[model samples]
Target: MSTSSGFSFPGRWRATFHQRDLAVFQRVADRHWPGAEPVLPRLSRSANHGLLWFGAAAGMAALGSSARSRRAALRGIASLAVASAAINTVGKGAVRRERPIVDLVPVMRQLKRQPFTTSFPSGHAASAAAFATGVALESKGWGAVVAPVAAAVAASRVYTGVHYPSDVVAGAALGIGAAFALRGVVPTRGQLPPPGRPPADAPALTAGEDLVVVVNRESGSATAAAAVIRDALPLASTVECAPADLPGCLEKAARQGKALGVCGGDGTVNMAAAVAATHGVPLAVFPGGTLNHFAYDLGIETVHDTVTALTSGDAVRVDLGRFRPGPQGPEGADGYFLNAFSLGVYPELVRTRERWAPRIGGWPAGVLAAFEALRGSRPLTAEVQGRERPLWLLFVGNGLFRRVGPAPGRRHNLADGLLDVRAVHGGRTPGLRLLAAAIAGPLTRSPVHAAVRRRKVRLSGLTPGTPYAYDGEVASSGTELTIDKLPEALTVYCPMPA
Candidate 1:
């Protein structure tokens, strides 16, 4: 006892904590809760290698009707991955805590396969907490559902005598920390502002009177979004149709309805905008596509946003880009583009993706198309402003697009009345050139990249059968195409900022 006369206080404190931790572990091992033998042990076993959480993620992605649900599931998985990595590699090695002796614990409650790894912070607890926290951060209802499971998983570690209460607590803390850290880097979707919009005169839909919603069956827009519209606006007519029938349905809806709504991607929105404009009807957009560029830019990310607008009659006038002779009307260009018009390999990529999308899925087909478009495709040679040039990509946006946070492309003002044109000069490497153009955006004029705001651009000298794309729809524009803008040509319903 007299050997170390001047022992540090911190050292003594640590020793005391170790004793308390062991005492708590023994108590947990001695205690028995009825009905725990059948569930928690199996639950912990199922979560041994993050299988349960992955299964939960898959279920959410498959069954959840909204984009937020899908995003929540993805965020949960990401947080879990981060937490698992931290605890297994860093936390375990740092602490070097020995596993609690399970002598006093019942054989029935004990795990079938005892873990061999060091357990200072429980990996299962960490993953559970992280996933639940992540999901909760994105979607509260899902988080509420997942939180109980996470708590159960954490408690099970202590109940089965595999980990001390302190270990489970530490793991959960670390998991929550990891999830918050991720949030710090990327702001929550809810935090993003739905920007300023100049309101336009639009009729308030009384229980969706004279409102017709056209849902594209092939666009992969969420079915739940369509269902929400049907419920929110009981009197609204709903049409879920194939791509071949989309244009016809849209036209019919435009002719009959006082207002037209679309629940699809930018391409589908493009057709709806044209039809609505041609028929003199306001448009409501429900974001259901792979990328709802126009809807996102308009601050309409959910069915709720559109429903609120429809009920309130709040709206805005936005520009639509066009190829020459767009949706023939009083103020239109070849076909209208609500988001972007592109030339070069992008068209081929769209063509390929569309061709295979029915066989495979949308995202997978996109991946396959990207490989085909990049690997086997050649640069497009076209006449731009009377100068012949080889181009990797020629992009024209309906309005000036600006990048904000996670969105690589977004427009602050949809009625800017100018074409956002960007061209990537082609040489040895087309990919690099396109990347450069994308990064430079509307603020550069380098050797391989250039961007400008233009009233119109005359394009020609393309191969006779060369393809081009506008608003996600691919078409052959022969050897000539005129890129132009029709500013404030379309009126769309969007909720006015509070």
Candidate 2:
């Protein structure tokens, strides 16, 4: 038997199941309440162009304002994109099923722009499931809020006489699969390892015997974090320092300890790492900041992980980025960065975000600061390899960072002895080009953005006192600057890969 839409049922048990499922859902949809009849159709229509999901993602990015929320928002949108592609190209093409007829639903609830493609798997349901699952994987609180709306959107397809219950179910499964498949590429919170025997290669150390830990009190959750570290390594000497005193304290501690430990943000870690490097001591990093990017990359998520690594003597050698001012620049000045250094409006953006991060949080503050920087930023002229060029941004990473989706900022091989250098070329409308590059992501290749790998790079032709930032700390630079790699310069504790 075939429906009026020319959807012929195969002589198979699966076909019979699908037919029964559609009939049951059709009957239920026909008796929908008047309130829902009008409202559900409108809601389904609102989701027609993916506007509903996109708006939800934007809202998440704006309101949550943390690394986790931002990641959730990006992952949710990415999942929707993948789910839509799979449902439209593979799921729908594999079957010749047709959409449900309008007669199955109230006339007021029928969607005007009904999908014309085969409907064995509903695209709307797939996108909704994928987005919700992806978001929940990153942040349960936001995912909880999005769950009901995703469910409603999926059910709306059946209510508006566009998809059968079976079609929605298949699409949802496809979407969930897409989300799971993309997990390796997405940045999510690291899971804590179960307590067990330490790896044989772990470094053996007496608890707190020769360890000196410097904690930044200004960092978020510093007090609690310090207490956790103290409990885990009772003999370790813990020093609490104000933000201003962190560098000096770290240097002092580095001189006095067998192993130096740091519990703070990227900036604090950068300083402590320098001190440890200068003193030729291994370092232990604990995540005690708003966004512990370096520590996360190193697989150190908690104080327990640090304690385990310390006791086991598990450590890894990593590279450091060293920046030096030219002869025309500051006198006798050089510094190290573990993550990256940027010369462009990025410094300004960082300063602006720091001013507002306290009130609104990191991600939202970054969003606002980015808009302000893009709107008012001017092109900077620099001499790269002795060629004068107009540039918007110059980024130098200590090592090759992982390209996760559209962002390239996380490094997997910290010991790689190369600098990851990327630049944004100034064009007729450099600001607008920068915005386009941001939206297009790191995957899209254009003349506006260029990247390379090298051991060293030198830039000149900058105005005196131009600002540059390294590992989230912004400072003034001389007329000329040089960046080079310090391969395997630092030893740091990290968990063994499973």
- In TM-score terms, which candidate is top? 1
- Residue pairs with colliding backbones in model 1 are 221-288, 323-334, 324-334, 325-334, 326-333, 326-334, 326-335
- Total backbone collisions, model 1: 7
Regions of model 2 farther than 4 Å from truth:
1-15, 18-77, 84-168, 180-203, 206-208, 326-330, 435-447
Q: Give the whole-model CA lDDT for all candidates, comma-separated.
A: 0.82, 0.80
lDDT by residue (220-293, candidate 2, tens digit) is 66677999888889999999999989978998998888889998889999899888888888888988887787
> For all candidates, what are the clash counts?
7, 6
- Per residue, candidate 1 scores C-alpha lDDT tens digits across 365-385 of 999998898788778888999
State in Å the error of residue 494, model 1: 2.2
Query: Which candidate should be chosen as best, given lDDT against the real structure?
Result: 1
In candidate 1, position 459 carries an lDDT of 91
- Candidate 1: stretches off by over 4 Å: 1-10, 215-228, 239-249, 287-291, 325-333, 385-387, 400-410, 418-422, 427-458
